[model samples]
Target: MKDAKNVTITDSEWMVMRAIWTIGHATSRELIDAMNELEGWSASTTKTLLHRLIQKQAVAQHGGSRPFTYKPVVGEKESMAAAADDLFDHMCAMRAGSTIAGVIQSRELSRADIANLQAILAEKAKTAPEEVQCNCLPGDQTC
Candidate 1:
């Protein structure tokens, strides 16, 4: 399986990548035609993005020929997950403990969200010793 990189792409690139992910392997012309309505992007713009994607190793091309077929090197799900994680990590590092505290203190959550979060915490609290991978720092007491 291909490892997903924490690669950040522009909004335009994300639009194209999402479409390509949904559309499967395609040629530049096919991608441009399919995305034109959504992005109002010209064929040349699409070609440019394909070029950048290839350079980033996120997209691979058919043996360099006219109307070459291009496919994503990373799976859509993995890429999406990695991007979300990167975003969360950035936000956490920026806000420090306040980010987590805010989530814990929020009282306006929907019933479903609160219930699900409670269930997750309950499950974590009951985790057996053998299944635990403690990350408690020095001087920090074990749960």
Candidate 2:
């Protein structure tokens, strides 16, 4: 299995990955049907996406029969974290806190999730810098 941080999954591919992760393992027909139902994708379109995933080594094909099983080669949680990190890396560092706050405000988090976040923030508060510098360009340009 390839590490999630090393693989770059596109948005469409992420949709397919979500389905595969939710299903655990499935055949092409199963994926085709799921994609069709969820995204109104054609069988060929799903097949193409599957082929691309296979090429990227993010998914694997198994069994010797006509209807082979496909499983994720990358983990869902790890992939999501990596994607989030990638997104944050492109944004101004100073805005990350407020951006994260916006996401937390918009998303429905469980009690445990909120607790974990609070713990993490409490720990970070000890050594966190007073100000975060913007890194949008060379030197000290702000976004």
Candidate 3:
């Protein structure tokens, strides 16, 4: 897959990706079965989504048999982090902390998830500069 900001995955595509990510590698038949069990998607529907994913370079196909196996070309963490960065960039810098706090309050985070977030924050704190610079161009409204 391309950089997280450039990767535009639909909700349906995310479902198929999650299945492949969880399963490591899977045949089209296996993908259909897993997606059907997970999202009640029909085989034809799953196949179509799989094809789209391949075209997007989000998935890689392998095996020389009748039913080719597929695996994710992009890692889940990379995708999520890129998407989160894209989202965070849209908000005002001054409200970033409050926005993140609001998100934390809204979600039911697991203990592990909380721990991971804490660890990431701690690491960032250690290396964070005194001031962050804005790289926006003259006509960019996002800044």
Candidate 4:
């Protein structure tokens, strides 16, 4: 399966995406106006951002008015997960062990989050055989 669509946002595009995500839905004019205050952007800039978002399948458009209304096409969870995966992939590709260690060390988890992650790890460990396994190959190990 493909990764989630939302993390596809570029740094610049994220500003636009946040606006759309926050509004849920807004007219292009409204968006442009909103961005002008935060970014001092021109209408054309907002329009370009909209086009980029549409191309990425991150934003949805509707209405036949002069300016269409746009909304976020990706759900919040999908967006967050994709963002996390993207960051993880970058870190892994760079230096896997250090990246993982840094994440564990740096993250500020709530009690619930810590408990949940611990429970999940325990469950996986219990269900899994002793060795770490790859299920992709024909001679796959215990996965």
Q: Which candidate is the best by TM-score?
A: 2
Best by lDDT: 2
- What is the Å distance of residue 133 in model 2 from its true position? 1.6
Segments in model 4 whose C-alpha atoms lie over 4 Å from true places: 1-7, 93-143
lDDT of 1 by residue, 1-143 (tens): 35776456667778778877888888888899977888788989988988887777778888567978888887888888887677665542334345555857975778898899889868967863534332343444343
Pitting candidate 1 against candidate 3, the one with the higher TM-score is 3
Per-residue alpha-carbon lDDT of model 4 for 22-104, expressed as tens digits? 88889988988998999999999989988988888788789877668888877767877788776765532334445666787
What does the lDDT read for residue 116 in candidate 4?
90
- After superposing candidate 1, which stretches have Cα over 4 Å from the reference? 93-143
Q: Candidate 4's C-alpha lDDT?
A: 0.75
Between candidates 2 and 4, the one scoring higher on lDDT is: 2
> In order, how many clashes per candidate?
0, 0, 0, 0
Q: lDDT of all the models against the reference? A: 0.74, 0.94, 0.84, 0.75
**Candidate 2 pairs with clashing backbones:** none
**Clash pairs (backbone) in predicted model 4:** none
Task: Report the C-alpha lDDT of model 2 over 1-143, residue by residue, as the tens digit.
Answer: 68999889998999899999999999999999999999999999999999999999999999999899999999999999999999999998989999999999999999999999999999999999999888888886776
Give one digit per residue, the lDDT tens place, for model 3 in 16-63.
988898999999999999889988989999999999988988898898
Q: Which ten residues in a row have the lowest lDDT in candidate 2?
A: 134-143
Report how far residue 97 has shifted in candidate 3, in Å. Answer: 1.8
lDDT of 4 at 91: 35
